[model samples]
Target: MTATIPLGSRISGERLAVLLGEWRRRGSRHGSTDLAAAVEMYVLDGQLPIGTRLPAERELAAALGVSRTLIGAALDRLREDGIVASRQGAGSWIAGTGARRRDLEIPVTDGIFDLAKAAPSALPGLTAAADAARHDLAAYVTGNGYVTGGLPSLRSRIAERYTARGLPTTEEQVMITGGAYSAFVLCLRMLAGPGDRVLVEQPTYPNALDALRAAHALPVPVALDPGEGWDLAGVEAALRQASPRFAYLMADFQNPTGHRLDAEQRERLGGLLARTRTPVVIDESLVELDYDSDPLDGPPPLASFAGELSLTLGSASKSHWGGLRLGWIRASADLLDRLLSSRFAVDLGAPVFEQLVLAAMLEPAGYAALAQRRQDFRGRRDALAAALGHYCPDWTFTMPSGGLSLWCRLPKPMSTRLAVSAANHGVQLAPGSRFGVHGGMERWLRVPFALPSEHLSEAVRRLSLAVASVRSCAGVPAVNVPVA
Candidate 1:
């Protein structure tokens, strides 16, 4: 008989109930579909990992204030979809590794707007850059193409950009990777291990949290407010108490919430981390996407304030193009050497052609592309905000200074339910719990404005429909319903 490896941990009925906040039947129907859809969304969003043992049907029903028959019906739906598996005597567990296969498929169909991903479309001049790169690639075709630490010329360009941005860097301090995700994983693998705690903001990039989990690092979250920015006191408390192996933060144009740490907060955070000698990884993927008139007004790189323990990460995926798949890490020479030693386990190096294309994008012509993106994004942001105000007035959100998405707080804690309902209305959303470390921010949602203005307006209209369905289910009155 083969021994089954134990799943990470079992979530209690109480915790699961908190995660399934207000998952009532929508669309004026009392059925198991809503419950089933909510669970599917939770699993798909990484809130519920595969192989997790679910609570007993009776226990779950009691916790959710629903009947056991309803819970059974919901589990039946999950089982049919391969989202959950049941045993004769043992119990139920989240099945088939990570998200339903259907949800992962991004279909290129019209009338369906996917607001789940925050990335924008490819920038202008990308084709021209790729064409130029092919010509440049001919020069290196003869030599061995696999350079683990990345191409020297590309690294030099990346290092120069970092130095110009207030942090003195050199080619030796930079290591190129596939993208920002790769850079983060490499850093985490080098710094943390199983059972080690990694400090993070309360709400952060979902993929980063997934990366930390993959590295087996226990994430300790410090509260960060969308309106007020980082809670330095909470961060200090976590650092002093948790003694985390490292702290991963998005200092500029933070994802989902789109809050940037101020200069003073940066200094204070750096000083505290330096005092503790804790290594910090600053994700600057969205740094260059600032919508401000005076780009110089943004906070300086966090590495400028921190000591040797700090490392900065940047990527061309956001500013230039996601298809390019080029990102770099800026660290001291010693740390760079350590990361390089382990880099081979993941990838040989970033593609030579992509590196060349990114290098060209860093030149003067690329600045024009970036400026055009800024203007386009600013207009889209305004359109999204207006649409949200017109369609869902009860919802509240702060205007993001920069970054791609709006972290919105729904009138009630129905983000997960709303996401499930929204999918039925031909719109996809990233619920708030996706960004949270645990599963408690059921009142929030991340609405990306990276799509076209018409799509943004249509998404809001669909969301209003979802909200109405929820209100109808809960017997609440809707005062305003915008005409589509």
Candidate 2:
């Protein structure tokens, strides 16, 4: 039986207006065309998700301060494009079912440069680690190899790493999963239920948002600034107003923006959530990937402040290698038990060999590998920045202190169009709105620096071409085209 989604029944008028940020392009003749394009972009980017009922035409017109006729014409354009479907009595909804469509994904063929993923390639030592793990795997293969709580040795190593990082944890407090994303889904299931509120930072990791949506949780977004990082005041207000059951945060080297919470901000957040008694799951997957910054000098884990109310999630995907597919949750023993009990419904446990490989990577030698990885990422980041400056000078982005990507702003609010254009030119780009909760941030883009330096240069060149294509279509002058 397909369970019904509890939330996303109807979008508020005010929310719809915010989603249609700066929808009207300069020199655009028709208001209806502009509105239709904006709504199409919103649905394509998964902001106004499929099956989400749009606000009434009258209500939207009032919110947008436009005439109802214009709203009706806009909906008509959307229906013509197959972006929206409407019935006489049931009202209008985004086209197709709420589930994602595979056809929407760009094919991974030759000459395609995919910057959609912020993951790095496997480390130099991965093969050696896998080979070494085979010897260790022999011991586990003698049994059924179906341990629910994960291998004791691997859990101990993960817990010790957490303790070394200042958040004292025990092996019993850790629950292993296939990857950080899996751990996030598990935590969401254990922490929240249908119709429960989950507070999150705006422009967070896209997959995290998908997990929340899949769990049928109502996500309340707090605005996060690329320049200033978290808007603590806004977060505090949301906590006080919504009193959400659970909160999800990326406190260290945040995804896309690479914004880290300072000590004072962490302290303030801790106090607010403590008073509200809201349980938070902090994703620290990129914690060890600090570039110019030193983790030793940075703020302690947010879990250290909230004590039992906070759960810290860590992964080897960023620091070590993505192929490892290893992640763990650091929480109280009671919470760990609950996670373990709930985990069985999904799977028995992660593969035994991969756990051994991860355990080996957590040793002293692995720390040395991490240092090398950090240096490599720093170089790649600098390379990407230099390439973007040379090729797409109009694009603006802060040089990230850490993490694998830069949250860039285009000269115009054409990120969705740019993404489509880039894909046609054999480059896969994640549009700015993909990170946003609603359809805002249309002027922004997430450019990953995890590729090789040469690939980074090539990507920027292709992106420059894509930008020219979009601008030309918009009847805007394309100046300063970089020579490839």
Candidate 3:
């Protein structure tokens, strides 16, 4: 005989208890499917938000009057459907929505050590900076305390740092905002509007693309050639063809691909950019995190070449910690003045505490701490590369000397499928298509080795299994590809 499962607790606690007792007697065979169904009913009824944390396993099992083993099975099934996620110690949360339509469960697993996000948390000395910011707060407590225009001291410090980096900047040429994305939004608002063309790399950051859409700008994609790093020739061609009014470039330690434009290319691109009169928005977020090359000493800043035509955005997120939402834009003095006046319409400014903290981090000692972090990241990158080389030979990848991720090009165009398969094995990966312009990077995958060495090795092992799975399904003849 079939058994009826209570939909939710809405029927009253007594009725739920009675119903649970009835279902418990039906045994495991009937209870498992019923439990998953009940969870689905809760989601459909809007009882849980995407990313809502669920109760503890013991508590949930007790409440449902079911064994923990049964609850785990139900959760496993939900996870297969992408309905929920359970971190080993971090508890489970409802996965977010996706473009593809499927019954929601938990989300894709980023690696136990997630290489997806390039940024890390604050290093060891951040507590001292936080303490300093607390002191700074005492003087500002009497004022409005809203940091819409940013703390003056921070603006000056950022400008000074820009000057130190070879790009002459002044306090008037800077404006502090939240992170890089927030800074980009503020600039896009001031520079472009609906129907305006903005050029971006083909395999660009997804959130930035979303921001462009939010700004109502038409996005024109310039493809990045995995073989030659970013396609300089394509960039030039796109400039002439698209005639976009604004553009964004990460010339140093670019995100997915980890490619940096050399001095000559920067110079050539800068001249070409000037002729187009398109304001280039350069994300120098990862500039300080480089690992493969010699420490940057005297090369001209990417913005130096762009001259008045550039707006350079920097952030402490990657160099410091993602938790610190501090980012600044360095532009021509006049542009900075204009942006400052226009910015009030969106946000008052970054939080005063964060500005104070970042300002403290900008000091010489703070930079030394960051240097240590860079060295650590370098070791992790090398370790990840070694793991990949040892396990997955058919896949080709470029070793980004400094950035957080390795942009790997696989032998087959199965990045999306591989991401799905990887989730089944407990490793979440950012698909190559996520980076491509208008969905083009099907053969590429971005992997980061930013986690601890042990997690990096495990992630690589899972990735190799995933690649093998993808290859087996593709049924293509195996061909060797070079990966550094």
Candidate 4:
């Protein structure tokens, strides 16, 4: 499969120059080191993918003006580092192991506790709704089995929720897809073409990066300020400069930082977007997950101020169950239709039974039954924070006012390495750069507090041990250790 790099990918021009310069400064005593650096340069430049066959040792040596021995040694080093592999007659191939995507599963091995995902346990009423939907599914599946815009009832429920939130949306303005991610792609296809810029926040959602890349829209990530919570001014600056086709901003209970844009900032951003005629894709996936603050007194949704240029996405996966695989989008009637038409190329909308189940769960009593999950998450958040304070106090983090994860800024830029180390100690952590734009953001870690309280407490303890191990390995004195 051919992988196309975004037009403005960091793998271009100046960054390439910097990488070559750095390698040049590291004088190769053996020429093999230089050849190893060249292979890395090719990978960094997007010229190689997993399993790409490299030129034969003699061929590469002749091309690079190096000896066959140097090429052989370089290939050996690359193999040892797991960056490449070789076969008897096949020469060497690039191994795309920078990171591997693993299926989401419950952790049960090596006494490990997974704090990697931020999702609540399925609440009480889902099964009842599911059972009710099974009858609906049996009847619904008998008809023409293609679903393009999802079931109408679920779309209506989604639109009603947006209208109730002050977005003035109509059911006709809604379309359903696989999940929030599918909704995002549909929006991208409708609003952006290849090479068109799309705005995202720095240190934002990792999967969104993958989505944007797959959509072929260049992601222009504006920085999010940890001090101010959300970056309203940065949004305005990016809008003025990039003139992106669409901007993906998390206006409520943002994922990693748990920062919600206050009313004033929301209005300001909404107005800025409106004036610039830029479509703002507001992802409110975590809206049902406010913890310390009550949204009853908060300002209206950004869509209220964005008018026709706003697109809203919501999912049952984060708020309900990932297994549900249901998500919806609210946008202008014209835009909604365009997205729906473009979506047929992706997949037949979400499963009919899942839609019925989600719609049933959106009813008043069903949602109330799910509210208990927020309280449960709060307990785990508190437990994890308290454990971290008592154990790994040196690692500074802001207790998120709401949302599933805490964004912790480590004292050093070793988060990826730290995650590998943490896994060795029976815990998994997402490296901060996973949320970063291009190849930035290394001095951070995102820990989810959405697990059971006991599990979260134990995860924090293991995390503390991991930090100690990393610090000992680095020969650094731990500072700012918090006391309970």
- List candidate 2 stretches off by more than 4 Å: 1-103, 474-484
lDDT of 1 by residue, 230-256 (tens): 878667766877788999999887887
2 or 3, greater by TM-score: 2
**Please, what is the whole-model Cα lDDT of each candidate in the order they appear?**
0.78, 0.78, 0.71, 0.70
TM-score of each: 0.76, 0.79, 0.74, 0.75
Worst 10 residues of 4 by lDDT: 475-484
Compute the lDDT for candidate 4. 0.70
Clashing pairs in 2: none
Q: Model 4 over residues 1-484: C-alpha lDDT tens digits?
A: 3333222212222332333444443555756776675656444222332333556776655655557887788888877766666667545666543433233322235667666677667767899998888887877776986767777788788877776666676778888878887788777777888878888876577777777888777787655666566556556766776689999888887777778887888888888899999998888888877776444445678898887989889888878887887788888888877776677687767777788889899898776775677777788788888877787787677777678887777766566557766777787666664675544344667788767778877887877777777765542111111100
Candidate 3 per-residue C-alpha lDDT over 1-484 given as tens digits, one digit per residue, 9 for 90 to 100: 2222211111223333433444433556877777765554333222332334566777777777678998888788777766666667666665522224232222444434455565566676899999988998899989888866678898998888777767777887887889888899988998899988788876677777778888878776655655565666656766776678888888887777888888888888888888778789998888888665433463567777776979989888878887888888888878877888898888877888888898898888998897888888888888888898888877778777777888887766666667766766777666664564334355678887668777888988987787777765642121111111
Better candidate by lDDT, 1 or 2: 1
Against the true structure, candidate 4 reaches a TM-score of 0.75
Clashing residue pair totals per candidate (backbone < 3 A): 0, 0, 16, 2
Which candidate number has the best TM-score? Answer: 2
lDDT of 4 at 264: 83
Alpha-carbon error at 478 in model 3, in Å? 26
- For model 4 the local lDDT of residue 163 reads 69
lDDT ranking, high to low: 1, 2, 3, 4
